[model samples]
Target: MNEIETAPSGEWQDVAARDQLDPDFPLGVEVNGQPIGLYLLGDQVHAIEDVCPHAEALLSQGFVENGVVECPLHGAQFDIATGKCLVEIGERDVRCFPVRVVDGRVSIKIVPV
Candidate 1:
């Protein structure tokens, strides 16, 4: 499980430790009641909406490969780094949050940066 901390709106909130992220697996977290998925690509961390727009599945539970994540339920695919829908079944693109790492901790800003 990933650690979670709440913060005021537009502020960066600590979500997990940098060591908790895996290149092949995404971490699911909820910030201010919004489900978000955390992905690690190389040394960079990305944060995006977790829910599949075409269905009610968590994107974090999907299969990840080569910067893309495929919805486990309906086969919808999205770019993990850009949150862009890559498949027709995805319906639309998802929201992306800004991520920052400091002192071995992973933090994200839900508001547009």
Candidate 2:
């Protein structure tokens, strides 16, 4: 697999390859000790924080509809592409990361501070 970028902390790790992912299901990747949600919508891959801000639920376990991922526990909605919380129940925004496919290999650029 090809690496798009290293973590800000300079740690070496491999999340997953492009072919290993299921486009229809949410994939979980841990980079720099952070859990990231990886999903494929259409022909592009998106990465966001896996944890729901309103609760301890995993966003990856939530439902994805019309580009919005709804929290399974409290029914909070968030735009997966932008990580913006869509409902008033959860005002906190989820973190987003840059995802890129290089040479048929998928790699996500870890969000840095």
Which digits, one per residue and each the tens of the lDDT, describe model 2 over residues 1-113?
12233456533335677776665578776676677788777787888988888876888888888788888899989888999999977669898877778777766666457
lDDT of each: 0.90, 0.75
lDDT of 1 by residue, 1-113 (tens): 34366678699899999999999899999988789999999999999999899977999999999999999999999998899999999999999998999999999987853
Top model number, lDDT: 1
Query: What TM-score, over all chains together, does every model reach?
Result: 0.94, 0.82
Residue pairs clashing in model 2 are: none
Off by over 4 Å in 1: 1-3
Worst 10 residues of 2 by lDDT: 1-10
